[model samples]
Target: MAIMLYYPLIEPPRDVMYQGLLYWDMISTIVPDLADPDRESGWVRPSMMSPDMAAVADAGLYTPLSIASHVEPSVGIGGVDLTAKLRAALADLCSEMPERELKPRPAVEDPEQEIVYSDKLPPHCVDLLLENGLARVARREPMLIVSPAVHFTLLSVLARQLAHDLTAWQRVADRAEPCLPYTDQPWAFRLAHLPATGKPERCWQVELGGLLPVPDPSVPVSEVIAFRLKYNDERVRLVRAIRNLLRRLGGGEDPDEVFAELRAELADALSDLDRASQRRRVHWMRRSVSVLVALGSAAGAKVSPDYAWLLGLIGGYAVNVATTSMPSLPGDQGVDLSYLQRIRKAVE
Candidate 1:
């Protein structure tokens, strides 16, 4: 149910002379024997040979050097070109990858052609992901499982979105009816299970489980809480509205008494909100919604607005809606609803 998102400001390339240093340096490393008469005896030399000759020398090594050069190389005797060593280190850091790993490279020189790895996905994968959401048949059940391919940098995006969703939900829920009577209600949260349909026979679970505090107290309490309270209140109102109908059918108890019990049960379900357990509550909020929806669908129960609330929390869209000025939201409902957007706007 939760939808996490991130919006970053990307800068395009600037117009400056590349000076072909990487080119020269790269060539120098691979074909140090090639002569350049401009100013050099070695790696420090400037190339004065005809641009054509220099180009040829550069080209001679380009293909091989491209294949050989790495992201990082080792410390050298005089800090000379160490790209090969550096690359090895990076590969090792990335789980001891072999030198032969087939990394992504464009035929033409494109700044966009950056590092590519088999286990990692680039930004370009976004379109495919969104497309799959539409055509795919509820992959891995209804849970919003975080991708292992995700990096710490990316998880930051998810954290931000989660905060945003909380804010938005607070607003909307506050505005609803029979409001939880107080803003400072203490809550305690626990994870509940919904059995899985397929072979695994289990529902989505939080990898990190714990209680958390309210992420942002600076933001104003949400208006939606009041609205939700109002909506729930209507249950009683509606029961009363049709009291005569019930009486005509010879009901045993006063309609008000019966409604009072139902209302009390609903209230009890919502009664405790332990701020001390806020972290656990938030995580529960995030993971539970997705599981519930999956369970409900499996069991054929209709989802409610509360389900939507959970989705927002799990995905971080609610935070965006809550913290951001409405204008800051994306035109697309799905994108706008991301918790990340809310965090981004709040911080921005």
Candidate 2:
């Protein structure tokens, strides 16, 4: 018995579609064998694979005859046969095509530096996977189940929706002081695409009801900032508790009491930040102390290895969220924080 799951590769803002087309055009031209693995002759000119050519294709982009065939197989034991098939097809095509210089050769730095070739596809390949209509599949056996263009187009639509929500959330977090530092940290909640094996992984999945967990756009930026400050304060306290416990262990003493005391101290600190006239009171200095304490506690704990490991993981996430910098998009010049208060009326 065999089963298969399919996910489309391309979907929605038009820009992503264009980019994916450009990437595909480039690869199909430079590596024409990719398009027709069994071609006996006729090599494509690399110059013909420009962004303009991609645009033309985008304008007339019709669903490919077979989506399953276009989809690169997964890279593992399950895909072993597919991988061999693809390799053999490419080998046959390449044997009949004339070889040409693809790019400038790298200069040798040291005699011992062995020349190596990268098997990984170019970075732009991400444009294809992240764009609007590519289908993702889980298969037990190979089969032509869908049109490539149709799957890509469908998936692209979903991806665009996700991207829009993420962008809006990014806007809100940029205005919120507490979330700003954690924006770029891969572990913290933020939009990111991480490479896993040969595929792209959506690193940020924090969402509420299919949308980003953010306050209404109309809410005053000040209120959002205040909310984040309070939220961060709680995390700070947790970090402190962990640290105090570790510090006590360092002195060959039990950390239970120290953890309780540190929690109390954190409560006081949060109070001070809340009532303080200046926002600077809640800056990195106060947060760093709490983080350090948590780290210390994790190090000094004499508990079972599992407990210690759990403590370490929590403390680490806290520290990373507290100290990391905010992320910015490619075209983002800067955000207008004032817009936060001007957008729609506040919603609960």
Candidate 3:
């Protein structure tokens, strides 16, 4: 059966902030009559009043002006000190609010995981998968479903790490397109299915295939393209090595040794990318490998959540890198010249 993992999109807090600001501004505007000394001279006291008299006249209001005296009020208008009437109004306003409105609203529901059937696949997605050798439609049974959460996590890490460079960030976005369709939505992949052995219970397994080559001639030969091709090739090699090492870990290989080798390879790749002036790719590679290494250490003990996540991430990256770097199809003409001519005609 296919397994699906769904993460709900959450709205930002700006709406709540705007609501609060609007309430505060409205209250401030409506209460000015109580705080403005010019509007009500009694709300403010005479500034020239003796200290003893000022202390004796200590009311909730700021400073009370004597009608016979023309002394300035010690406390200025619109100060923190509020008249009894204004304070009562504020208390009433606060009391009018429900208790539930004072506290923060509960957070949205957490992400979910579930088992599903192969028939649930969208027609377009299934057709694309069949055309790309990702699935076989002849088999009417459901395959093991795998989540794309790891790939999404890696993309997030890459995006954040390389945000400073616009060109580099764009490259990362371009490279992420292959897995975007699956990862961007709440969907899963047909990892593998159990063979029918006529036993009481059949054993199902999960597996990911290596990269598939594509043809795209639209990309002209350039330093940037060359760098991308080389980087992707190196990444494929690293992914294969990681998969092999993870497998060996189950067979009692030394975790420390395997991790050390992986770290060294990752470092070398990062260095090479930096030398090639591929800053964005380098940032992504560095962050991805660092996280993988951290998570890989714990995975050696047993198959943990982190290990599964790392596998999905690396697997998705490997597949996307291979597919995204392919040259554009030769027969695919670019923007229609006729359309441009029509625009020019309209302009004339």
Candidate 4:
């Protein structure tokens, strides 16, 4: 069985590329808009919010799982007839969505007493979601709940703590919050089809994907060739670790402690990946300097590291120099790990 996960909300909130690639089996998300009935928004459900997932599924990318479909409806609670109360709550929250605000409201305005949908979803139907939504999904399957949201966001261990109550069930922060590997997509690069030459570093945006590099004048052979070799080969290692961890998670029905241990082993994988990237960059810079020094001597030009303009002129087509040091990575295991912790508790 593929490892399944629920990314919070609908419409691919953020960083879905990495989220989709890693940590999923029949991967997709289906967070229900409990107030969906009230809003006349574009779509009815998460899966229906196009571009349809069918094309991706056909390509074997990943299938979208409906939150509504995966979870069972709440039955009852404490002989208090929670079913009726929850049904009532759902009705109230769904039917009572307030108008979506386009402008800021007056500060002195009185708040509406009724449960309504707004910027922040009201937790009026939270009980129903807990009993049926999150609880059922976690109990039946070990799922990962991945989200980028921080400072806002799982539960505990033994003694049969409520999935929502336990210590592991806490919205505990990740080992550390990680800034993405790349800030804004790294200039969406693509190699041009033109024959390679060493003239000048030139590139242009294609109508379709991204910048296509026509390396007529420039692009250093050493850097270009060594591009594939990042000096630090941790990506493959990390990928292997993820696969191994998931394999254990998938096929083996290990004891709770063993399972927990495996996950804990990977808890810092994100930090490790970042650290590896930092090291690779450091290697890249040092290698570039070495190449430039050799080239400068051969060309009968004195090159100094402090002359950034000269470095840029010399290395523009060649080197990617290291400027400021990368900040030390924090311990945030990422938000998903906490949800995993919650799932473990809920299932128990």
TM-score of 3: 0.22
Query: Against the hidden reference, what TM-scores do the models get?
Result: 0.16, 0.21, 0.22, 0.26
Question: Candidate 3's error at 88, in angstroms?
Answer: 61
Judged by TM-score relative to the true structure, which candidate is superior, 1 or 4? 4
Off by over 4 Å in 4: 1-4, 33-47, 52-54, 75-238, 243-348
Residue-level lDDT tens digits of model 4 in 1-348: 122233333333222322333322233433333336565322234445444344334445443332233222322111222234334333333343332221123331422211122212223334443443322122222222211110011100100011111112123532221111111111110010111101121111101010011111132323322332452243344445444533332232222333356444344443454465365452221111010111212221222223321111111222122111111111212211111111111110
**Residue 118, candidate 1: C-alpha displacement in angstroms:** 10
lDDT of 3 by residue, 176-286 (tens): 211110112211111100011001111111122221111122222232234334555554444445445434543434445554556555445434434443443321211
> Least lDDT summed over 10 consecutive residues: which range in candidate 2?
203-212
RMSD of model 4 against the true structure:
22.0
* Highest TM-score against the true fold, candidate: 4
lDDT of 1 by residue, 1-348 (tens): 111111111111100001011101111111122224663332212342433324424444211111112111222222222333223223332353332222222232332122122112122232333342311212332212222222121222212222233334434556321101000101100100101101111111111111111223222222112222333343333323222222221222322344344434333322332222242232112111100101222321221222211111211222110010111211111122111111112210
Distance (Å) between predicted and true CA of 64, model 2? 36
Off by over 4 Å in 3: 1-227, 230-233, 277-348
Q: In candidate 4, what residue range of length 10 has the lowest lDDT sum?
A: 150-159
* TM-score, cand. 1 vs. native: 0.16
